[model samples]
Target chain A: MPCRMTSLHQLLASVLMMAGLVGPAAAEDPNGARRKALHNMVVQDCGSCHGLTFKGGLGSPLLPDDLEGVDDSTIATIVLDGVPGTPMPPWRGLVSESEALWIARGLKAGVFQ
Target chain B: MNLLRGLTVLIATAVWCLTAAADTALRGTGDLGVIIERADGSACIISTTERAILSCVDGLGDLSHASAVFSPDQRYAYIFGRDGGLTKLDLLERKIAKRVIQGGNSIGGAISDDGTLVAVSNYKPGGVKVFDATTLEQIADIPATYGSEGKLSKTVGLVDAPGRRFVFTLYDAGEIWMADFSKPGAPAITKLGTAGKLPYDALITGDGRHYIAGLFGEDGLAHVDLWAEEPVIERILDGYGKDDPAMPVYKMPHLEGWALAGDKFILPAVGHPELLALDAVTFKEAGRVKVHSQPVFAIARPDGRQVWVNFAHPKNDTVQVVDVPSLKVVHEFKPGPAVLHMEFTPRGHEVWVSVRDADRVDIYDARSFEKRGELSLRKPSGIFFAARATRTGL
Candidate 1:
């Protein structure tokens, strides 16, 4: 069972790496618990203003279709810096750059949808 | 022939017994309430007396930031959804009596003093829409237009006031307006004047005498005395938290849960791990208590002896209880991950807390702080009791 689990993890890691969704640092801990924490933050914290379904609320809609034209880097920057003159607060210290990118990719991919 | 008659009688008796079991005995809803299951877009009708969920009503859309208001009779609940859905839920039947997509995106709602109208605050179209409580028909639409450009501003902090009036603030416009429905169809709007920069949410005193709005862009809160002949917006605690370096706020502090403890108002300070106390009479800074983190809700128990506080995200696992008399932290404990909201029983004996991530609602003895019971739910957020029907600005 241990050997089979190792092969499955490798297969999943390779697919994620090929998709350019993870950095080298994140790859070192592919199935880390921090990933689960980050996912919860996106759903609960970010979802507080942006709708839970990402349709729209006080914050703008963040659905996959809504973010179609936006790039992952821009999304990551917004996640870190937040939009000025609004209730969106910066998450620089709370979320790392790579994690923000991961969240951005997940958002655009409708992983949270 | 005798055998066939016996069989028919037995089947009829069994069917009657099954029907009787399906329909429980009629009971009062005074000890009943609703909990918003945010993730599933549904609400659970809970019995506070029994500390259990009676039924779950589904199909309410986008309950991410949902809130509810009860009718004068306390038999119906008006649930305001983030997707601009207003659902009128019947407590006895445990179903959505009527639902309507009133706007594109909505914040919250309030019911008229006479229970004739329900008003929704919208963000997409940026206005307030009033509807008939029973029929769910549009009564009037008041746009939150401000400035020289006549731009529409998003409305927040919508609450019902005495004499069939609704009070709310414009987020982008920095103003508060009161819609008086004395004439029913024609609403007499009174601009209460400038609130601060980005007046996010507001609350009216239990006596319905004062309306206070918390500012996001500034330090102080905007205050208005509703009892005055000509209500004017006054700024209080205008220079609060100016000495400390600003911290990034993960969750905005909600003012609707502002607590009135004894002679003071215990309010959660934005971007600060503190609860600010103001003299309820003079509106001056009375005292401040350092809490665990940025407080999301500082709610006082019914008798106003203790105030319970919950923090924002990441630090939200902890809840602290403050003694109103000494203005000190009396107790602190971790219920579970993601403690979204807390509601005290009408008499302030027991408090029901919603642990979202844990999918459970834990009931605690308000005085002893003992865990009394628990009910499993799905991502519960807000717990509104039928007792709110009697309060001024629940």
Candidate 2:
């Protein structure tokens, strides 16, 4: 069972890496709990303003096509600093820089749709 | 005799099928309710007959916010969408009666005290628009123009007060205005300036005596006494969040959900992880009940014994039920990943909670805090019951 679970994890990592949803370095972190929590935050919390499907409700869409040509750093900055004069509030206190980058990458890669 | 027996069996079968079909149709007169399917941009009318789930009628509006005001007879629902689309939905027919683009961006609206007028507070045109409830025809347009430049500011926290008046706060301008339609033709406007900085939301008391607005640019709330002839304005809960620094506010704390549990008002504290209880009559601080995270909706059960609170994001999964008298957290449960809104049965025996991420609505015993049942839904956000039909400010 342990061997089968390890193989499944490896397969998931390979697929995510190929799809650019996760970088190779971050995949080695072995923080499944954090990833799950962040996934929940991106889909449920961020999904409040952005639609649950990330198709844009009050905020703009976070779909991969909508985020085309938007760099990782810019996305990360928006996640941390937020857009002023808008409903989008900053997430710096809630998420760390690396976690924000992970969310940005996942959003850009259409990981949460 | 055999032929008669056959006819009887056929009649029994037909009666059985008819009964089953009637059970599905379930909705009796005045039992229709609407649930906000935010993702689908539609409001699903569920039959509150036996708390049964029905079907959704589509094409409500673009990015439909959780703002729905029912008609006086509880037949039509006035929904204000985020993209400035105001659609009137008929609950009985389960169809959109009329829709209009009242502004470029809008938040929420209110129905008049007499229920003859429906008013919408706008974010784009920065004003309030009043329409006839029956025809959906525009009657009055009052802009929230500020200062010498006459620059408009987004209007928020709109509530229908007594005496045919709609009271709201100008968000950017930090002022509260009341438009009285009592005399007809044109609405007489009264502006109370310098209420505070950046008033985000406002709420009027059930008696329509006090109109309070929560300020986002400042640390306190502005309370206006509407019954007074001169209309005295006072700031309550001053320096409530002055010591705390600004944090990431994922969702703005809603003042509308501030619960009136008996004489005490249970409000979600801004920039803090606590629920502030204040004396409803005096507007003085009563007690503070600390919760899991920044509380969004701190609503009281109908009996006013317990206050159920759903927090802002990151901790939105957990709902804490606070004992009103003791001011303690009694029962806390993690409903799902994204718990959006909750509504109690008319008597407050059952609380129907919408778990958005779970794609279901869970019914819980309000007293025991036990899960009773669950129903499958699609991204349900707000669960508004038909009991709001008789209430003044829901």
Candidate 3:
């Protein structure tokens, strides 16, 4: 009875989220088309140096394992203000703070795929 | 008993010597080809004479932006991996002869004109390290640091020119320096100041007269005449992209793939879906051809009649072939998803293209534009030929 009740609750939550009734924060990305484009950029453009599969290449790995100790804020900072004296160029001019934060969180959650 | 034992030892020695002599005879210029693969960092030693793939060897690490420089004889190939692994592979044995981790990160490398020295451009330590070509021993180290502050800068556009000089651009320093190795000991450094804001990549003219550096921070390119008495730096295509809004550059385009067809130089316009034609003699823009997306490589055919161009991600599947004379896109084809590289055979009879997402390399007849054959590979990218050894700055 308890398991059934938990399943019902989870199903209701998913339905609400899909219906845009829950998670109002997701609506912050005003343009759905722009968000899709950014997601593709994260996968393909970032994939250039970080490996197509997001394993690692000329740049370090962005997988959850490699980014374990690094927090989302620190990751966001590095993405916005790149590390100096390195091949990583500054993306602050191109990536906004909100978009950078979204990228960092997504990378931490292994969303590159 | 002593006589019998002596005879057996003599027989064994004779057989070993005969096998060694046979191997030496089989290894020649005829048995030369290059196989570039990124399926877990490995290469297949190809036999050009037989026109077939030979042996596949493993252990090349992190092959993103990977490149190989062949020896003068084309017997040994020095593969530079993205992880700073410099592996010397012997084509005869189909194995790695020697390997060393020169730095924590490396972009690419070049070999001296005489084939005596091998130099690598590093990203981690931000310098150029030269090694003995045969022995793979470190010979010299030149850190890319300038100004009174001694700040180290990431090096790019590393290439070897005539007169025993190695030239490269410093990203952070915004300068170009030539390391003259004509004399012994430390190389004489000539710092040609401030090439541009960000010189991403560069290539020497096929004639080996000019070294052009592509700028990322600005609209123009920095041009240096290697043979000039003072080697003055000139900027070309000034205000090329000044009027246009910046497009999202998913991957940086390499200027090394810029093609020189007759009097014209076919180059990708930065952050633009167009390919610009520059006059090789005047170093000025001649014309432009619109393409599918931002061009990655504008490679010219051997006869210099046409240029085959590929685009950056999203539009990578499409390839446009431009007729040099008219400066028009003559043909457009979609080979497959994630097209990575294209290479023409020595005589430009057959052109090979790598379709990474499709797991096949398509070979097309140069003139008729018909599919000839295909080679199955795992995540294939660059298709280098043994003929590259005959040229400079490959």
Q: Cα-based RMSD of the predictions, in order?
A: 6.5, 7.2, 10.1
Tens digits of lDDT, candidate 3, B1-394: 9999999999999999986785567657534566667646877766544445667788988676678888988888888877788999888887999999998777788888889999999877778999999998999999998779987777888888887778888866778888989999988989987888877788887557788888777788888987788998999988887777756554577876337888898888877888888898899999889889999888889888999988887678988899999999989999998788887887788788888768778888888899888777777777777677767887
Q: lDDT score of model 2? A: 0.79
i-RMS for every candidate: 1.0, 4.0, 4.8
- In model 3, which residue pairs have backbone atoms overlapping below 3 Å? none
By lDDT, the candidates rank as: 1, 2, 3
- lDDT by residue (B1-394, candidate 2, tens digit) is 9999999999999999996787556454466677888777888877655566656778866553557878777878888877677889877666788988888777789999789999998877779999998888899999889889999888889998888888999988888889999995899999866688877788877778778887776778888889888786798988887777755678877776337788888888777898888898888999888789988888888888998999887778999999999999999999997788888887788898999879888888899888888888888888877667566556
**Model 3, chain B: what is the TM-score?**
0.91
Chain A TM-score relative to the true structure, per candidate = 0.75, 0.78, 0.73
Over A1-113, each residue of candidate 3 has an lDDT whose tens digit, in order, gives 97566456556654554354643376653256766667656765676677644665446768666787887779889888776534465677667877787777667656554
TM-score: model 2 vs. ground truth: 0.83
Which candidate leads in lDDT? 1
Error of 1 at B236 (Å): 0.4
* Candidate that beats the other on lDDT, 1 or 3, i.e. the better one: 1
User: Which run of 10 residues does model 2 chain B get worst, by summed lDDT?
Assistant: B23-32
**Candidate ordering by DockQ (highest first):** 1, 2, 3
Full ranking by TM-score:
1, 2, 3
